[model samples]
Target: MRTVAEVARMIDHSLLRPELTTGDIETGCALAARYRVASVCVRPADVPLAATALAGTGVLVGTVVGFPHGGNATAVKEAETRLAIEQGATEIDMVLNIGRLRSGQLDDVEADIRAVVTAAASAPVKVILENAYLTDEQKIAGCRAAERAGTRFVKTSTGFADGGATMADLRLMRATVSDTVEVKAAGGVRSLDTLLAMADLGVTRFGATVTDRILDDLDHRLRDRDGWTAA
Candidate 1:
C-alpha cells in the first residue's frame, strides 16, 4: 500500500498558470514545503521566487522551457535553460517541438532537445511529449528522440492540449524508453486513485496543482483504515 507521503513525493506541484501572481507562487511553494513534494514546477520568470521560497525546504525548484507550445527556436530554448538554472532551477521540463516531430523532422527535434539538455548540464531535463497530438508511432518516435538526447524523463501532456495523460500512452511511453529514462505524467491526475493507477504503469513523477486535495483524500482514507484502495 502506498502511504500519503509516498504519493506526495512523486508530485511536482504545478504553478505555471500565466495569471498567477507572485503571492500565488509563494503560497504554492509553502504548500510544497508542507507536503514535502518532489518539486514546484513554476513559470520561467518565477523560478527565483520559487527557489527562494523552497530554499532549505528540500523541495527542488523546477521551471518550464518553450512552455505549452514548443515553437521556440533551439537557441532560445537553450538560453531559457541557462537563465532558469542561474535563477535557481534544478530541473527543466522542456516541451518538444510537436510541429517539427509531426513534420518528420526527427533530427531537428532531437537537436532541439539536445540543446536544452546541454545547457542544463547536470540538472535533470524532462522532455514534454504533449501526447494529445501524436500517433502511437509519433509518441514512440518522441521517446526515442528524448532517449537519444539523454533526457532524464519523457513527460506526457502540457495540460494546455486537448487531452492529458492516458493509460495507453503511459504504457507505450514506459515500454519504449529504457529504464534509465523515467516517465512523468502531467494533467488530469486529480485523485489518489488516478495517481496510484499511473504509478502502477511505471510513472516516477507527476505535475499537478491539486496536491492538497489528493493527499488529503489519501490521509482521510488511511485514517478510516480503508487501506490503499481509493475512497
Candidate 2:
C-alpha cells in the first residue's frame, strides 16, 4: 500500500472552478500546504494569490492556459503561459487545440503545444488533452504530439467535459507516450481506489479537488493496518 505522504504528493489540488473567489483560493492553498500535495492547479488569475499563500510550503503553483476549451489562438496561449510563470506559477496545464486535433491537423496541434512549452522555459508544462472530447486515435496522436513538443506531461481531462478519465484512455495514453512524458489523470479522480487503479496503469500525476478526503482516507487506512498513531 502507498503511504499517505506518497499519495499526497501525486495530487495537484484543483481550485479551478469558475466561480471560486479569492478567499476560496486562499483556503484551498492552505489545504494543499497542510497535505503537502504536489501543487495547486488554480485559474490563471489566481496564480499570484496561490503563489503568495504557498510560498516556502514546497507546493508548486500551477495555472491553466486556454482552460476548458482549447480554442484560444496559439499566440494567446503562449502569452498566457509567459504571464502565469512571470506571476510565480511554477507549472502550467494548457488545454490543447481539440478542434484542430479532431480535424486531423496533427502538425498544428504539435506547434500549438510547442509554443506553450517554449514559453514555459524551465517550468514543466502539462498538455490537457481533455480526453472527454477525444477519440482513442486522437488521444494517441495528442500524446505523441505532446511528447514531440517537449511537454512534461499529457493530461486526461480538465474535469469540465462530458466525461472524465477512463481506464481505456489511461491505458492508451500510457502506451502511446514514452517514459520521458508522464501521464496525468484528472476529472472524476475523487477516491483512493480510483487513483490507485489509475496509478496501476502508469499514471503518475492526478488533478483532484478532494485532496483532504483522499489523503484522510489513506491516513486512516494506514493507521488501521499498522496499528500506528498519528503524531
> Runs in model 2 with CA error above 4 Å?
229-231
lDDT of 2 by residue, 1-231 (tens): 999889999999999998999999999999999999999999999998999999999999999999989999999999999999999999999999999999999999999999999999999999999888888889999999999999999999999998999999999999999989999999999899999999999999999999999999899889988998866
Question: For residues 112-171, could you state the per-residue lDDT of candidate 1 as single tens digits?
Answer: 999999999999999999999999999999999999998999999988889999999999
Q: Which lDDT values do the candidates have, in the order given?
A: 0.95, 0.95
Please give the range of 10 consecutive residues that has the lowest summed lDDT in model 2.
Answer: 222-231
- Candidate 1 Cα deviation (angstroms), residue 104: 0.9
What ranges in model 1 sit over 4 Å off?
A: 226-231
